[model samples]
Target: MAKTQEFKATERIEAPQGGPGRGAMGGGMVGQKAMEFVPSGKRLAARLRPDRGKAVLVVLLGVVSVALMSVGPRILGHATDIVFNGFIGKQIPPGTPESEWPQAVQGMDVVPGQGVDFDAVAHVLMIVLAIYVGASVLGWLQGFILNTVVQNTVRTLRQDVEDKINRLPLGYFDRSPRGELLSRVTNDIDNVSTTLQQTMSQLLTSVMTVFAVLAMMFWISPLLALVALVTVPMSLLVTAQIMKRSQGQFVAQWRRTGALNAHVEESFSGHALVKVFGRQEEVEAKFAEENDELAKVSFGAQFVSGLIMPSMMFIGNLNYVLVAVIGALRVANGQLSLGEVQAFIQYSRQFTQPLTQIASMVNLLQSGVASAERVFELLDADEEPVDATGAAAPGRRGEVAFEHVSFRYDEDRPLITDLSLVARPGQTVAIVGPTGSGKTTLVNLVMRFYDIDAGRITLDGVDITAMPRAALRSQVGMVLQDTWLFAGTIRDNIAYGRPGATEDEILAAARATFVDRFVHSLPDGYDSLIDEEGSNLSAGERQLITIARAFLTDPALLILDEATSSVDTRTELLLQHAMAALRTDRTSFVIAHRLSTIRDADLILVMEEGAIVEQGTHEELLAASGAYARLYQSQFTAAAVGEEV
Candidate 1:
């Protein structure tokens, strides 16, 4: 009968957006400067250290393949010379050797009266083909090995991230958005995988090809090789300038991506609430703003990085023109053979092609490193204090005592101070107060979700801190106001309380908590599949299932925080009866705002502003005419007025 609170339309929505006390926005990297390339690149490279042997083999195969392919053009050039020599010889005097020919033909290896040697050309072509075929086979083998190494490295990285998430403290999660954390784990890690997969083999091959082709170029003609080398500095200048401009844009692009994902996730999770409050337009407007920001940064990053390829191509063309004119002049002066000139031209093309490939791969490397930095940040976060080694075992008798405990979420604002209480075995202690009265915090301390700042808490005369967290928690059972059920069958959800519970034990717990009343009516009975959100079940039905889960644990201590607040009157009454049966031989802590539910509690403690104000049985507190009497009278008068109306 208490007055129900109405939510105003102007109330601020609790969407997971950027603000103070919520940690950094945009996957915890917003407003921070872009990370330096060298350190991040090195750290990313460290992830590949485990597979270094396979990586070395990949590099060796690439080098061997490039070496074989580099020799093809020079060998093929010999065939060209043979044909040219034979044609000249056929036009000369009969039966005359090349030494007796004119000065222009004297240097050519040709015999008079001989036509083109088709058999010699065929033999050269076959050798070149065989070299190319060997190179191709080696390339394929290296690709296969490189792929395996990359996938294994990524798998190990994913496992590290998963383990890191478990080690972080509850306070870290309270300050971070769920969506942002998920983005770091899923989106960032996936981008890292793709970047490594696409860039590793190609980058290695291109670099090796560049060196191999350069050595061949100099071996053919040093002067022409130097002319081709003129473009190397120019290409590097262009690459450095463009990459410097695009690096920050790439960082912004990924940061905005995380923010956009966070907004969308929060909006979808609370879509019903948003629609009920008529805030769809506001949500859409915010989405549009973030989407526009992401698009703008993406465009800038791509546009700047796109200049590398065209710029490299232009310089390469200039180098090619210089090499061709010089080589033709050298050939006309009889300083080089026509075949050598042709081979040099092919080598020029090969040289510039690898440079172009290297320039293009820079963009992918930058983006990958950016994502790796974000993932490394998650792995470097401060974790919870390590559990005690060889800690003492907890007693099964649930006698909990809090002695002068003091705690605070923030250093400047004190929450619970000098709080002391004791709950003997087989007792029911009810806590009653208004909102922000530290009722939930009390139980949370008992569960050790957040360690206290000072003083000690104990179970069965042993300090809770002296026992391992898992050992201490194993003897306690808790039921929160919000119900959580994974996507699984009803029987599976119930069995989650005890992993190896028998079918008979599960049925017994379900029947004891009245969950069988509705579950039996479903077509699949206990085998019915529940979606992740459990939308298939009603509110009361879900609560009943959670209660049944707690019952199956059969713990010595139980904590129920507003467990009946969301159910209807009939359902609440049924739950109260079931809870009574469950608490027959266990110590139970109940936190409630509806005073009627705690009338029969052995001890009722009234709290105000994080301090205990009064304590006694319900009738005794009412007789004393204190804070408890005021709260009861107001509710009783409101109920009577509603009945009269």
Candidate 2:
């Protein structure tokens, strides 16, 4: 095995901690940047501006709903005063003697229950009922319209994220975990969805309700309205304090959530390795640590935010008591009526109800903003460079050359420097090296997966950099040792190479790679379903399918990187035969561990530390007794020892 960097024995890796003022729900793990990078309020508004027409319609409907609903208490007050007047008017006339009033009330049409005006009462009640019903209908309509607007916005946001993923460079994926990205795409986006669906409309309605209720309260009696106003600053003070404390916890909460997701993803993907090493307890322990951290931060955030409702309710009740006492005094002084006092009390409740809702919504909106920030960060990431002006090399013979190429994954450490090679059409060049000796990096350079810092690589004597990436990759085919097969029928997997390959073409390729051997044995034949990652098939069978896939492509050049490593001896022999046939008229670059597989190649190159150390035909290299000879001998001895066992 090649010497490569490894984790030091003394190195300790710990779960990351969030920064100061950065709460749990915010993406704020150490070395993990906060997801909410954008601070501009205008930018967020701009994102919603595209759906402004729908938003405006929703607001209009909400206005109508709240306007109709706002007068409900006042109208009910009118009905109350009407009933009071119907009874009291007949019973006692103003300025009548109190002692004589009893006889006077009786003498008038004031017989106990019969004195009340059912006709006027019913008339006013019907009007109030109609207003409430209309308000209900408008409320439902506005909610429905707002839901459409919110859902479409979420749909468009998801599409943008999807498009951004495709545009991101490979380096970005290299630096980020699959789970972290998955969290942003799923959890973070869903948070935004929830906020849009539920919180947004409620927020608008709550604000409208507060203002309308305030106006109605003042119209009823300014004295009672002044008493209600005393609670506003106090309620706001409590809400502000709780929000300040809770914000950091929320940031920390989400950051821990992301970490937990990443850990689960890593553990599950490598479950086989975990079991083989009997590290189930260790995995569970680590999971528990993250889980516990998440619980702690989530509880802290919720506990702080939870205090708002009760605190605001206390203030509301205090206002209710003050309004009732003060309004009663006013009524006794003839400054207000019993009906007006009742209406003012209801208005007080209505006013505080929205404030309570708005406080709770502020917390939810904070979380949503945090999630949106993460999504926007992904959207803002730098994308892979593409030059549409570049030429399309569509029909070129396979002639590849590398000259003084230099590259590095990091600027501080070079992986390949001044590397040069040449491979002509119809020639097979084998690259042999120990692990991490830059074999794959070299192949990556040829495929333009990474651009070189210095020097140029050419295909058919034309600079590869001048060719469009899609056009260049179309002419090359690769079959890696770690064969990847999606969940599909065997026939579908084979046809994936060309996408539009006919039945005859797929069958022919399958036969050529001996994939037909196993397909015939399965109950479904060529239609056999391969489970996810081809987990249902034997390792050798998956390799055969991958080989068949490459055969179907029939590209100008073939790259086989340890392609036979996973197959058994008999399967390897069959694949070698198939590969030999495939390479008959094609330029092939083979990277392998087994020396026997590449013995008949037109040329063999021995690589060490990113440079070609030896190059010759098999017999000539064996005669030279250099790096190639030593590698061959070591493998020969290993095979002999294996046979004896």
Q: What residue pairs are clashing in model 1?
A: none
lDDT by residue (tens digit), candidate 1, 196-222:
999998889999999999999999899
Model 2: per-residue Cα lDDT at residue 159: 98
How many steric clashes between backbone atoms does each model show? 0, 17
Q: Could you say which candidate leads in TM-score?
A: 1
Best by lDDT: 1
TM-score of model number 2 = 0.89
Q: Local distance difference test, per candidate? A: 0.85, 0.80
lDDT by residue (373-482, candidate 2, tens digit) is 66777888888777458485745578889999998876787778888888988899999988767887777788887778999999888788888888888888999877
Model 2 weakest lDDT span, ten residues long:
2-11
lDDT of 1: 0.85
Question: lDDT of model 2 at residue 134?
Answer: 95
lDDT of 1 at 214: 94
TM-score for candidate 1: 0.91
